[model samples]
Target: MLPPRWRLAATSVVVVGALGVAALGWWYADGRAAGPLDSVIDDRLISRGEGYEHLLWPLADLGSPPALVLGMVILVVAAVRTHRRPAIVLAALGPPLASLVTELALKPLVGRTHFGGLSLPSGHATSITAQVTVYLLAFAAVGLPRRALLRRALIVAAPLVVLGVSGAMVSLERHYATDTVAGAMVGASVVCALALALDAWNRARSARAARVPLSGQAGRG
Candidate 1:
């Protein structure tokens, strides 16, 4: 379990991410075209020439349905082996459910369409980011020796993976740059919120169990 201080920090991140998703959704409402920031971001984030396609294509495909399903299964199995039900739930259900909320709720309500498809939060970006978050948590759950290098490596790798996938989305015109940002925010927020809820439930259940045994002793006395 994450320390309470760490969980507080995570909750703060979730709040910020949710606000960001909402702000972008509001800004891009009504099928709006690429704004000033989108064009600028596209230029900086994905201006690499054709050779980059070799790398970018595969990174973007990591967010695809088949790839996400496979990754989720592997992560969930890892969590199961560790006997962490909260981690398992986050791994198994978090990404897909978050993706659905973006596709069905946010996109249509925003009415932002690109290439004849709803596109506020890029589903690809959402899936990829959430998957990475779950995998990171699962790694922690595995009870590996706490090594500074490994922790730093994860901190570096997670965002790199998200950025690579999001950059590919912009490069391919699969989504506007802001859409990818919103997708990332949605993915992170949902997963973090779930973690908070599960933690609270576990603490409450433990407290209740402790009370039950005390009540039994009191009855005998």
Candidate 2:
């Protein structure tokens, strides 16, 4: 099996590449009409109309402020219970950083207007994606063997939640398919990068600790 760090690194590269591809497509398409790939999925979802709005609305609302607060609470409690400082720090920083990147950087840089405002990477999609990513990372950091089932469940659920939110956004005409796809990629990339950094820090600290005894022996001699 690949080392965890290597796996994380690979995931980061793939996610970043996806984000770049989405951005390039958005930029290259410019003022052109929506391509088949973008329009077809959205068209099918929207065809369901207002009848499905109520169903999707709650799923979409998971990205809202109240949901974010709840997610943060869960993250904090998990990190505290496990006494994982890296996880706690990541929980505190990751979501906000992702949101900032989406709002201040990607959205502005892409400049794709929707309903009179920038909406290249959907804020709702980013919010949900970032929130889920942080929670998963925090949970993993806990490393409770008994919670293996829960972790597996989370691993299965996170992507589904992202897809549900994306579908809701497109169905509601809140974002194009490309926007949600890009948002997912961006959010995943941000969390993956942070996770890899934390892993590297931990590995370096372990190496330093291991060398301390040898260094002490040399000094004593």
TM-score of 2: 0.86
Quote the RMSD, in angstroms, for model 2: 2.9
Please provide TM-scores, in order, for all candidate models, with all chains considered together. 0.92, 0.86
Instruction: Kindly list the per-residue Cα lDDT of model 2 for residues 1-221, writing each as its tens digit.
Output: 12575556547754774667466546634433444677788888888756888888898888766776687777767767767777777777777777788889877677776666677677777778887777666664345435788877877888899999888988888878877877777777786677667767878888999999999999999
Task: Work out candidate 1's RMSD over C-alphas.
Answer: 1.9
For 62-157, candidate 1 gives per-residue lDDT tens digits of 888898889889878877887878788888888888888888888888888888889898898899888877765545534332686886687778
Give the clashing residue pairs of candidate 1, or none. none
C-alpha positional error of residue 193 in candidate 1 after TM-score superposition, expressed in Å: 1.0
For all candidates in order, the CA lDDT equals 0.81, 0.73
